[model samples]
Target: MGAPRILVVDDNKDMAQGVAMVLREAPAEVESAYTADEACARLGERAFDLVVTDVRMPGQDGMQLLDVIVERWPRSKVVMLTAYGTVQSAVEAMKRGACDYVTKPFNNEELLLVVKRALRERQLEEDLQRLQAEFEGRYVFEGLVGRDAQMLGVFDAVRKVAPSHATVLVCGEHGTGKELVARAIHRLSGRKGPFVAFSAAALPDTLIDAELFGARKGAFTGADHDRKGHFVEANDGTLFIDEVGSMPPLVQVKLLRVLQEREVLPVGSSTPTKTDARVVAATNTDLLRATREGRFRDDLYYRLSVVRVALPPLRDRIEDVPLLAEHFLSRRCSERGIAKKRLSHRATRVLLLHEWPGNVRELMNVIDRAVLFCQDDVVEPKHISFDEEATAADLSEPQSYEATKREVLERFQRLFVERLLHECDGNITEAARRAGLTRAAVHRMLKRLGIAAPHPEARRG
Candidate 1:
């Protein structure tokens, strides 16, 4: 296509020419219209990428023309330039589908920036519409879930950053949903590139360089063909490096160079290739600590630490457990065409009370397990399982009034014999003296209570 065509509309010839000149300096060609009437005529002559119109033109003002543009060319971006700043007029212009409003005395750069951004958004929306039609809902951008205050804050941040070319660094503990956050960023970002992911731990130490930076054919053994690694393949999209903290030293150096230089020097290659993909890295380990300990490079940590977003662990945000649980349950149940299930009130209480060491991933696993084993539409407290012994025991075998009394009386007799034995090492006379009983009485109590000499290594947990 030729240079993007922009229509500049105003009643004053000088003002219209000034607006046209401003747009002409951009990566676009400008056509001037003295009035809204002329703008309508120009629209019929040829299509334009954007329309910069003064809001208060005579006869038919910018608002009336904007409605016409919306009715006829809904894809076109229209920005209203008003000399008089009226809240009512601006609001009405916005309601009528004006992309942006700029008052008189606006700087040229400000106007240009607004116009360029509006055009970019229009193009992005058009591309997204086309992609949605082409894909036919074959993909899933719906798995991410959160409703807590912090999560809402994260959502707002993601939305704002996704459309930009900024590099995002996700920091959190293991299984705190970093990948999900990355995916959300990808879906919200308007780039049409592929999403690629790689685990640092899964690659052999010797192959980290080639796996990330690609390798020429015959560069080494098992190299049958030239290759494109995650960086090249994810151009114009996202490159998600998970467990980035575990990246080997050599690879860390190279990755840092790529991030800083925006170019990749593949293994065995003389020339470096330019890459345009946005990098989003996630790590579970304390990178700062690793840097201090020399396990991770300090320079690399700071380079990748731009725009850091720390995710809260499930244990820290227990209030969201039920929301996440229900989200997972509905998703899993839908996948299998089963009736959706909800955790009972009591079961939800149990879930909230337990510590979630594994974070959102752990919550998903529990919900999956519950959905698999549960037959009814509601999951009960007994149906839930906690891998931790203390939490599990509390739910599985709660203390009853009678059971507590019986255990207390039995524990008194058992401890009396055990204490004596510990003091005497099972000598009958010494044990009886400590227990305040005869040798036969001490032996009988020990036999009745089934108490034995305690083993030091028996209770490791």
Candidate 2:
């Protein structure tokens, strides 16, 4: 909420002040510490977003400060400053958890750029931590999974408004877990009645009103007996209307009346019955745009959206893919009474790179299929497939067997190296170590595959 707080540590007073002055021009609050002990004292007093410390300071040097900062304030980003001859030391600092390093005698603009980058990274890490906390049961909401900042924001909104009686409009792309959110809201709403769900798209336009509001006996062709509707069934609780944007315009007017008057008027009945059902409606389409096009009632949209919750598409929160996949695997395995299957590293890499146009639903189906087809304990890339049309198109290709084989191998090699580099933070030495290969061999592979390390700052021996 405030300017990122930064601590500048250098033994030279003038140097620290000059660096602080340069950083002050940026969006930061800079504090000076002449020694590692002083910096430690300052850190103990308050948490900083980023710390800039010289590599060679009096007594405990920057490396020591780096280690202490890494241990004490793991979320804070540290940038090491060093002379040309000690670049290796700066790289060592990076291994010790420093984000990036800077050579001494740098200009204001260069320093500001690195500082800004570090702060941005700090914010991302913080968001990730918050997300992890939410995933680990800090929030009482259930059936929803994600630690992305956007998802956490949704959780915060749900927590704030679930206790109230305000109507909620859950908007997102299809299969983004809008219904899960609605169920969570109801579960946490402290309501006594059941959580009733109705799919507006599945219901016929002729019967939607009768489904939402009770119909008296002999009211319609199929109405042989009096029937209670979702509003009454969900009385004193939540009524989740899925794909609500598909409701016919005529039904929209009746829904708006229920919201306005807190009463449901049955079809073919003159009397209106009072009801207390909290409405939580979801739609994948742009209801506001639908209103502009006269397909939906604008007044009803406003009424249902008194408290809106928008779910983030899977693509926007790729970091949560592993967790979601694992969750699905365990749940499905338990359901089928089969042993749990794990995702191979290569399979997970492919999942991470995929463009999930169908959002979470597509991912779930992919995992489900992979589990069923995978004979081994681990699900591999060959076992995972999506888009039947794409599969058919590929099958119809007339390429020679050799050409197809070469292409597939090359693609697999590229993906493998890229994922390793990413996991190792683009440090070729670390990647090589993890892959059990020589650094020179890894470089050769990268060159052959036409791949370059993405993080230049992370390059190390």
Q: Pick the candidate with the highest TM-score.
A: 2
- Model 1 ranges off by over 4 Å: 1-142, 388-461
lDDT of 2 by residue, 321-417 (tens): 7778888887888898998899866676667656688999999999999889988889877888987524312333345434544555576578779
lDDT per model vs. reference: 0.79, 0.86
- Kindly provide the TM-score of model 2 when superposed on the true structure, using C-alpha atoms: 0.56
Cα shift from native, residue 406, model 1 (Å): 30
Q: Candidate 1's error at 298, in angstroms? A: 2.6
The 10-residue segment of model 1 with minimum total lDDT is 134-143
User: Which residue pairs in candidate 1 have backbone atoms (N, alpha carbon, C) closer than 3 angstroms, thus clashing?
Assistant: none
Predicted candidate 1 versus true structure: per-residue lDDT over 1-461, tens digit per residue:
46778999999899889888888877788989988888998898889889999888889988899999999877778999988978998898888898899999899999989988987887788788888555433222335566666666666777787887777878888888788888888888988998998888877765778878888988888888888877999989899999998888889989989988988988889999888878889988888899999999998888877668888787655557776787688789999998888877667766766668888887888888889889998998767776664452244545443453344446545655666666666566777776578878876777788865344354222
- Model 1: number of clashes? 0
True-vs-predicted CA distance for residue 174, candidate 1, Å: 1.5
Best by lDDT: 2
- Each candidate: RMSD: 20.7, 19.6
**Per-prediction TM-score to the true structure, in the order listed:** 0.55, 0.56
